[model samples]
Each structure stands twice: as C-alpha cells, then as structure tokens.
Target: MTNNLPLTVKRSIELLGLIGLIAVMVIARDIIMPILMAFFISIVLLPIYRFLRNRKVPETLSIVLPILLVAVFVALIVWFFSHQIGILVKDFPQIKENVKQHIDSLSDWISRITNFDDKQQKAFIQDKSDDIMNMATSLAGGAALTLSGVFVFIGLLPIYIYLMLFYKDILLRFVFMWFKADDHPKVKEAIYETESIIKSYLIGLLIQITYMTILLGGILLLIGIKHALLIGVIFAILNLIPYVGALIGNLIGVLLTLTSSQELWPVVTVLGVIALVQFLDNNILMPRIVGSKVKINALFAILGVFIGGSIAGVSGMFLALPIVAVLKIIFDRTTMFKQWGILFGDERPAKSPMSFAKFRRKRNVEVKPGSEKG
Candidate 1:
C-alpha cells in the first residue's frame, strides 16, 4: 500500500505537468501557429527545392521558381474568381429574397400539414431565419478576419520560404547537432521521413485538387449549371477539409442552384455530380495518391479537422490532417513521443503468423468434469 501511494502520487504529478504544458500551448497558440504553418509550408516545398538544386539550378533560383509558380497560380485563381465573388456579393439581396421565398414556401407546406395559420408559420420561420442570419453573419465576419491575416502572412511567405529553402541544409544540420553526435543517423532518418511525408502529402493534394476541380467543373458545365467554374473551384478548395468539406460544398451548391433555378431536376443533377465526384475521390484518387502518406485513421482525421477549425478556422481545418500526419511521423521517430504515435495511429491491428500450439496454449483452460476443451 505504501509503495502504491508513491506511484499514484508520481502519476498525479505527471498528469499535472501535462495539463500545465497544454495550458501553456493554448495560451501561446496565436504566436506559435503562424510559425508552425510557415515550417510546414517550407517542408512541403522542400522537394522542389532539392529537385532544382540537383538539376544545377542556382539555389536562389530554385527557391524562387516554385514560390513564383505558387504565387502565380494563386493570383490566377483569385483573378478568375474575383468577378464571381463580386457578383455573389452584389446579388446578396436577390439571394436573401429567394431564400425567404423558399422558407415561406416550406413553412406553408408544413402549416398545411399541421393545420397551422400562415401568420403563426411566418412568425416561427422569421425567428428561425433571424437566428440563422445572425449566425451566418458572425461566421462571415470571422472568415473575413481570417483572410486578412492570411494576406499578411502571404506578404511575408516569400521571404520565409526563400530563406528556409536556401538554408535547408544548414537548418537540418542544426537539428542534427541538437542531438548527440551518435544520434545524428537517427535524426537524419527522422528528417528524411518527415520531408518525404510532407512533400508527398502536399504534391499529392495538389494533383487531387486539380483533378477534382476539372471533373467537378466539367460535370457542372455538362449539367448546364450557372457559375459552374465558381462552384467547382469552391468545392475543390473546401474539399481540402476532408469529409465535412464536400458535404458543405454540396449544401452550398444545392442552395445556389435552388435559388438560381426552380427546377427540381437541376438540383438533383447537381447533387448527383457531387456524389460522383466524392465517389471518385474516395475510391480512386485518394487511395492512389494520399493513402500511402496519410495513414491516420478517419476518427482522428475528423477530430483534427474539428480542433483545427475551432482554433484557426478554415485554414486550420484544411491543414489539420497533414499537420497531424507530420506529427505522427515525428512521434513515431522520437523515443519520447512514440506513445503519441501509437495514440494517433490507425487502430487496426497487424496480422502476424500464429503458431497453432502457442494459440492453443493461450486459449487452453482446465477442463471441468463435464466440459469439453477445444
């Protein structure tokens, strides 16, 4: 009992220490988050840096090229979507009217079924509508603030990326130096694995996004949907959030279609397009591209998304899984953090060859007088 008391006290102290660490992290999150994001972006872009260097490109040029490409790509997307965004903003009044009409129509149908008067129905709906609008406005304001922060980060990204890329080797050496000389080999292995995972995950995601965007855009166009490109791009970007993202995009698409076209068939067709794209992403694209790198289980992936959304909003949600995957890699490599790797790992058990005798011995129980032992 005395010995057990000491063990219990030690565990309580350990738990308190962990809680303190978590509190500190939460408090420092705002300052830490951007640097963490910068680190990850640098990791993701490292492959291109290495590839260019190997091809005898100047180190500075190597870093500049990929950064330029990413910048140009982002600029083109913003330019392409600027008009749609403006139209959407301008059409807010029309959208509100359409939404109100739909709600009134729905309320009427419900009232008819329930024998409620139109005034009662309208009152009920008006309250609900006000709540929804308030929530949406709050969300929109938050999103605007987040985008402003992203723009500020973007301004600094080139400098951060350039220095990180050019000095990657030195950075890696410093990391290795932080460990004992004998531990350098293991540190290098961990570094390589971390780099490989980030590069693979990012590049694969880019390809997946491009394919999904094209497929979704083509399908929407074929179905004669208005603002097909806009819808497709929006879906592609949101799809980065994993399961919930596509669903949200689908809801938005359906709402937009409902407002733009009164035809049920068109809405059904849009839903079908979303379903088909989801199927392709799940069965074909993800399995081939992201499966190898992101081996984290679905539950953790979803949890990560939710936590990230809570902390950093959409950008956090978009980055959650990749960050989790990177953390898993680091944990798996580091002796002290191996338990975290196990905690975050896929829950499936590995199959191993079993000896019949050992299995039988483990399962064996003393036979009772009337019991048969198998």
Candidate 2:
C-alpha cells in the first residue's frame, strides 16, 4: 500500500509508524523492561550454562546454577551496601548538622543579597512551604512506586531468564522459520555475530567493573576516604552507561565526599581521581577490552543512550548500545537496511565520514563555461 503512495505520503506513513512504535515502547515499558533485561542476562550466562551442560549436568541444574551464582553475587553486593548504609545511618546526626550548616549559610547569603531580614525570609519561606511540601509529598509517592516496581522487576527477572533459557531451541527455530531457506545462511551469520557481540560486550563490562572497583576504591582508601569501597563499587556500576554514567558517578563521588568530610581537599581529590580514572578507562582500558566489536560510533552510541532513556527510563539506557549493535549486525547482513547499518557504524580508514559530502559537491560542479576544457 505504501509503495503505491506518493513519496511524501509514504514518508508520513513511516513517520507515523515510528511514532507508534515509540508509543508502544513507552506505554509497555514496565512489562517489557524485565523481560528484555532477562534476555540480555541469559545471553551473558549462555556460555556458563553451556559449559555445565557439556559436563553432562542436568538441564535444570545447568540453568539453575548460573542463576544461583548471579543471585549470590548480587546478594553480596547488597549486603555490603547495606552495611555501608548502616554506617551512614549511624552518622545521621553529623550529616544532619552538616546539612543544616550548609542551609544556614545559604540563607545568610540570600539575606545579604536580597536585603530581607530573617523575619521576612522566614515569612517568604513559610508562604512557599505548601508548594514545597506538596512537591516533597509527590516525590515521596513516586519513590514508593519506583521502589515497588524495582522489587517486582527483580522478582520477575530470574523467572524470565529461566524460561528464556529453557525455550532457547524453540526460539531459535522460530527465528529461523521467519526467513526462507536461501536466507538461512544470512540469518545464521546474524545470530552468530549477535551472540559474539553480546558475549564480548558483557565480559568486557565485568572486567571493567572489577578493574574500576579496585582502581578507584583502592586509591580513595589510600587517601583515607571513608566508604571507599562503597563509593568505588557504586561508581563502577554506574560507569557502565558510557559518557553520561561517568558524569553521574563523579557527581555521586563528589556528593559522598562532601557529605562525609568538612574539608574541601577531599572533594577536590575525589573529583580529580574520578576524572583521571575515567580518562584512563575511556582511552586505554575500554578500547583494549571491549574494542570495536560492536562497531558503533560515539555519536550514535550517545544518541541511543539518550533515546533509550527517554523511552524506557534507566533500563532502556543501559540496554541501548548493545541492542543497537545487535540491530546493526542484523541490518548489515540484510539487503534492504544496509544503509542504516552504515549510519550506525564508526568511520573507518577505508571510508571517510566526509567522503559522500565531498563526492556530492564535486559531482554537482558544472563545466563552468568550458573552463574545464582548458
């Protein structure tokens, strides 16, 4: 139907379809996020599960073992963080005092700037308290909902993962059946590439998290920072999200330092350390480990992250690049969407990003009144 339509009409239909796709994604995010997360996790665990299977382990045991391992690992992290939280709670009085001091300092600065006495300032604040309280209430409500959603998501994840693994063969067959016999080779290649990319990316992430946790945490510990391990682990996990994650990790480190210490130098040191570590990770570690296996350029990776975040919140952002890479791999193998795969790829030495533009301009140049004959 779209093929018979005018160009503009066809484009309009495509645009509407794109909008509808996004709408469905956002509307169904809650239902989709857990399953998608499970899918990725299952992919990462596939090798280990396969290893156990090759050892003649029972199917149920093979699947259950890796899930148990992941659960234990997550439990350890939670336990460690909970212990740190307990320490923070113990220091609540000190933290409260520090916060109040900061607030009072701000109030005094405001008074000097606006020429309002404390009395008038108090009245102004009192007037806005209703609005502020309403906002606080709304935020608290949102927090409760988010917390509940997280628990539900966590609960469903393992179940989804188990089911995905158990039905893996059926799913593969289903995918194969979607294409013709002649296209099976291409489909197999796509599946192989997808699996390779996912495995490499995930393994690299695990290495990154370990390297960062030790590097960052150890440096902070040497510098006598409290909760160094906690800070390091948090930053390491957050740093998984690429450029934006590092910024957030830095903010978190700064906030933790500021809240923990009265001195200014620790904050500076924390920021400096995070910056230096990020520079090393981006320039040296990541390139060596993850490499260009995904072959996505920086531009589209960042764009995908933002778009994914907008569509499905944090889970979307986390999964965006790998998903795009998988899509690119599949698209590149197919005849119809090769152009899209190219757009998602990084500029290589063989193909300059500006080549097409220069070619177009050169081709459009006229003979210039027979000057070219000379």
> lDDT of each structure?
0.75, 0.83
Model 1: ten consecutive residues of lowest lDDT: 365-374
Residue-level error in angstroms, candidate 1, position 198: 0.9
* Window of ten residues with lowest summed lDDT in model 2: 365-374
Estimated TM-score per prediction? 0.80, 0.85
* Candidate 2 regions with alpha-carbon error over 4 angstroms: 1-17, 103-132, 348-374
Judge candidate 1 against the unseen true structure and give its global Cα lDDT, from 0 to 1: 0.75
1-374, model 2: which lDDT tens digit per residue? 43577867865765687699779889999998898889889999999999999999999999999999999988988998899889888988887776667657768999889888888877887889888998998899889999999999999999999999999999999999999899999999889888888888888998999999999999999999977887898899998896789889888888777777776788898888888888888878887887676678789999999999998888898999898999889868865455567668763333343764542321222222422210
Candidate 2: TM-score? Answer: 0.85
Q: What lDDT, from 0 to 1, does candidate 2 have? A: 0.83
